[model samples]
Target: MRWSKPLSALALATMLAGCESIFGSGDEEPITRLPRALTQSEQELIVASNRFGFNLLREVSARDTSSNIFLSPLSASMALGMTMNGASGETFSAMRSTLGFGTMEPAAINAAYRSLIDLLLGLDRNVDMRLANSIWVDQQFPLHPAFVESSLQHFDARVTALDFGNPASVKTINAWVDQGTNGKIKTILEQIDPEIVMYLINAVYFKGSWTQEFDPARTSPAPFHRADGSQHPVQMMFMRDAEVRSVMNDQVQMVDLAYGRGAFSMTLVLPPNAQPLRQWAAGVTDEKWQGWIAQLHDGKLDVSLPRFRLEYDEVLNNTLKAMGMATAFDDVAADFSGMSPRGADLFIAEVKQKTFIEVNEKGTEAAAATSVGTGVTSAPPTFRADRPFLAAIRERHSGTILFVGLIGDPRSP
Candidate 1:
């Protein structure tokens, strides 16, 4: 029922500039403008995403403690949610359990996702947050109408019929992905294979300015301590007595940075030890997460964060398989009976993600895209990330994390 409005020039610049822009677009994308309120079901869905998100965070950390990691759990969730529509039997059960959806009825699940999307689409008037979903089907493949309707109604996913045999299909799908991610990700598909009958994609773009902007002139060079105990000079952005919410314990300190009207904030957590934040990330459960948020109180502290940019790409097939989703990737054993008439033949070929984040004086600009390839597939206090730390962009009201990262080396983008 929603209609498109003209995109502003500022939005255009942010999309085209990717995350290199230090500040958000002068104008934000118009809010959803819808007057409807979120239902209880939708609210529960948000909570589910949070649970699934944190679990995934731990797995990501456990998999690679040595390298810097960044990802968009929201993007991956939505993409898989769409694909989940056509999943049946073991595939459905496995996906549901892995995503923390548990035994929730599919009807309720879709409704929750729909409401979550609508609510987020309208939450921040001053922040540009966009979520896009689409399905591309091979001309020769036959998709189920029920699946199509569910995706369109619940996800507002655009359905396109394409000839996968033609190379142009790759460009077309990539174009949609690029546009959805504000060009932060230029391509998601290199070449569509004949066996690849369809693709389910989700792209998210977010740009938010600090409620209290940092003075660029105050930025100075500071030494950033690496995990290896080496110090490297970095452009350290400084903030003094700025408004912030923080919490701490013997293990780590958490700091929250507000954006615009405060519906969203970046939570940074600094662990005391030189070990990667991943080592401790697995311990962040819903109850513990709630405890940290409840303990946060207003505080004043001098902050020093390195001005850095990170662009990361990761293939999640093995990680997901290890997380108990092995059957989905096994072509011979997989069952996607709900996706297409030939569901038995369709298996998730791969799962991959691309993310971009830039933190500077004004604010932060970040975008991420998750491609299922049929495929289907933190916090801080005291506040200095001079060493290794963890960061997450989350919605304050729902506690939904849109983006998360572990910063090990900032010297390279």
Candidate 2:
């Protein structure tokens, strides 16, 4: 969410036939569209999710107003949605309310997510977008079978049981995250805590080339003013004369830049002259956002945008708590019995996200990964056989005993 300096010129660009010099002239490709219309549930879910995303952004921005903030609300929602399947009682209610799910049942919510994922992945042939999910459980933890089944059926999440004590397990999980985000994000966890029993992860990746690319020759060094009144030189990309859709008012100017068959686009919002972007963004609501989007009309406008890249990482525990989800973080009050028979001991320990984004002459490339970790309130008792002990091998499902032995002295093998 790096803010570029306000454009020096906001007037319409001159109509010139020199398209070959300013924009690329390529054969038009067939537009790819959604396979089917969105179901009512899917549409509702998307609207609610957008509101949640906006709220989450405001909350995160309130922490440090000047810093660049970028996060994938989709990644966070999907990861939390998966975890929500394992919640029960007040924890479930709080999470559902915080996510803006309202009265939607769990089954309907999961179905909507599944349909939405399919629609997004198939929307545009030229755009590359992928979503992936996974669940990691400690070997000794007894997770509920129903939770595993639902995650696989609804979210297509990969489930694995790992030896959390082994340091190699950290590498294994990080490798999956690396692959999921196409290497934009390499690791989500530095180490697994001893009290942690499970982790739910989601990753999203997107790369799209602009419908009309900005010519590199037009890019020049320009002074970019910072919110702190500091000025720095930046590589500013210029579109001299392009038919761009835009909307403007006294407070801000908004422009839409389409990407690949117009299935997706990037909207650039610039605040009024001498006004800090954070000030304007803090007041942006869902209704205001929708109004701005609806007012966009086609026009020939000259655009000056700076190329930038950003990477951000943050722990969302406090953020979610402030958003009315405190019960989920409480070890004693949290109820996730749907996850395990011993759910009373389980609580959400952490919610973390890492994100990367780069916008250049071609288009935008972004990737993000979010992880939710659950930990036990107290350590489970450990059994140590310092004296004689009995050992047996048995089949769990059928309750068939295979072998038994009594060990007195290890030296007398």
Candidate 3:
């Protein structure tokens, strides 16, 4: 429960990138954060978006690495709606450097990642335009521009529907979440201010299958050994599968596996000889990160990760400083002098993130929802999250993850 090891600002920034797709897929249509102003060409944004999506998938496969994430793919689902205000621009760039090996030429990687950037940028600016079309075109679930607003918040990009630090407006946000999650997660924003415009959010969510599936019949209220070895009754989701990754590290057996479509996966560390380490040893570094990745081999073992749902609604008010993004949030030093012709003062209002996850043997079912709103008069773009979803906040041009989160668990603390 405690990632005690402090991640250096640079290291934490690098680590956050590893969480783009805590649970994700490439085939799903995107649920965009609307209220985008697209006066500039998105050529760069569009191209980069596609590559970013694919690279996200590749990252999922090499789950053996330090980062286990999936950037949402819905951004690339549609193209016509990527432009707005009757103007057209495209974005194309990638964050391959965020992954590994800076061996390739910068130009080549940029070209490859631009496809993804396009999609991410498209969602930010052109999503409302696309959503207007999708409600009629999409059959299963669709949404309208429930609310709208624009700001030169994060640098120069005009942002809309941001609820970050406000504590009074949870109802509206709750409605959207209720809609997007199909009511799976309710009142997640109870503690948030509907007026708070979230500028940056980073969320992580995951669910893992037990190597040995729990027998429905064997399911019993067993006392789970706490970090203190104390007992607590927990519903053990058990499953026995021959297909599993096994690694013995520090005498502990680690079982790691992925969910369907490899959207997001989980890795479990079990203590051996009933001896647990002092904390999770989250202090595992780049070298250990590599070893954990290499240890995935075919093996058979009985495993039981306490069946539980753990979630974190990370409010990045302090995280901004944690990730070196403090300037953007500060009213004084912040220079968002590009978004508006008026040279608008761009300061982050808030960065609210909510994540929910349930772990079971079959697979994981989760959703991430985030709305970074800016201070504006026009009723902050209404974003009704009413069904299952995955959301992101990125540069309309570069497509970096400003924030990402999942919401599917019904239980909220």
Candidate 4:
């Protein structure tokens, strides 16, 4: 009963920036108007998406406690959101619940994503951010018109039909990824599997200069203690008596480093010296995260951060299955009839993601690409990052988390 033709979905995120002016000097105003108000459903969707991100992080970190982990939850959700259009019955319910969609109807989920994407793209003018989706189909596969129409209308995805049998199609698809991420990520596929009848992809790119740029002249080599009791020399950038939003308690020290008129920011969470980064992260629930964010306040402190870069790649089939979406990957019990008449035979074979990030005296540049084969399947602050810590890039107004990661060792790329 296993279907030979599988569906693949991919998502990517990239961030790029450089040195810029200081934020919150006490007199500056936001350059752009505030983003529009969100509907109740939109607001609910945002909460659900963030919860899903936290859950995913917990699952990924638990699997490997001493490695750098980076991912784009928004990108993965959007890609799967597009694919969800074709799911029905138990398969559909499993995905909706796994994504924290709760009782929201499928149409509501699609509408929320459409509105959210528009709002994110228009929020900060000084920052360059883009979200794009695409659906690539085998030339001969029969896709339901309604499924195609819904993806186009709700996800704003580009639809392309090509000969999956042609090797050149890989280049064509990767070209779109390169363009979407502004060349930060050039490829998402080495070769499309013949059994994969369609590929759904989402790409995100963000570039924003720090409101307060670090002075490269002040950078010095410092020791970064690893979680394993080892230490290595790292290029630690220092900013003394800088005005930024920060909070601290017995468990962790967190700070918000703003970008582009304070709309987008990178939040860094540093666990106490006695606590392992993984142990601290394991206790973070959605409520705990929200509480910590609410406690951030403007303050003056000395800050030291390491200039580090990391690249992470992982197959997420097991992670998603662990999150309660196992039915979608089950060959016999899965259902995707909403996508096409061949729904009974379609199952996700695999899901994969590759990510890259670099932070230095100037700014941050990050890129991530996630591939779901139907087969398928931060901050800152005074606080020095001289040890393992956590980071998240987010939009302040809507509380939308674009990226999140854990840095166990800065010396390892």
Give the C-alpha lDDT of model 1.
0.72
Please tell me which predicted candidate would have the highest lDDT against the true structure: 4
Q: Which lDDT tens digits does candidate 2 get at residues 1-413?
A: 32111100000000001122222243556354455667888877776776677677778777744356666667778888888888899999999998879989999999988877777776666666677888888888888999999999888899999999999999998898888877777777778887788888887776667777878798777666555665556666777656666776775576766666666666666655535556666677656766776787777777776665545676788888999888888877888788887776778888887765555677765556667788742332111222222222211111111111222222210
Residue 366 alpha-carbon offset, candidate 2, angstroms? 1.1
Instruction: List model 4 lDDT by residue over 1-413, tens digit each.
Output: 45456777665655444424322343457643355778988888889889998998898887855479888988888888787778999999999998889989998898999999888888776677788888888888778899989988988989898898999999999998898877888888899887888888888887777777788899898999888898988988889887888997775699888886888889998987659888888888778889989998888878888888776766677888999999898888878899878877788876766676778776766555555556420343358778888889998878899899888887522
- Those runs of model 3 whose alpha carbons end farther than 4 Å from true positions after fitting are 1-175, 187-213, 261-264, 270-282, 342-344, 375-413
Residue-level lDDT of model 1, residues 1-413, one tens digit each, is 22111100001111111133344453554332334555767666767777777777777777765457777888888887887777888988888888778788899999888888877877876677888888888777788888898889999999898998899988998888778877777777777765676777788888877766677788888898887778878888778887788876675588888776677788888875555556677677767777888888887766777788766776777777877787777776677778776777667877777777778776666666666656320232346778888888888767788887687777522
On lDDT, who's better, 2 or 3? 2
Candidate 1 Cα RMSD (Å): 7.6
Instruction: Tell me which residue pairs clash in candidate 2.
Output: none
Task: Residues 1-413, candidate 3: write the lDDT tens digits.
Answer: 31111101000011011112333333444333333443223333333333333343333323322112223322211111111111111101111222221334433433333333334334422111111011001111111221111112111222234233443334554554454433434544445333222222111222222223345564445555444445556655444443555675555455554332322234444434544332223233334433554665765554444444454444434533332344444454443222222113334454444444444334444444333322213322111112212223323223333322222221211
Q: How well does candidate 2 score on lDDT at residue 329? A: 85
Candidate 3, residue 160: CA error in Å?
6.0
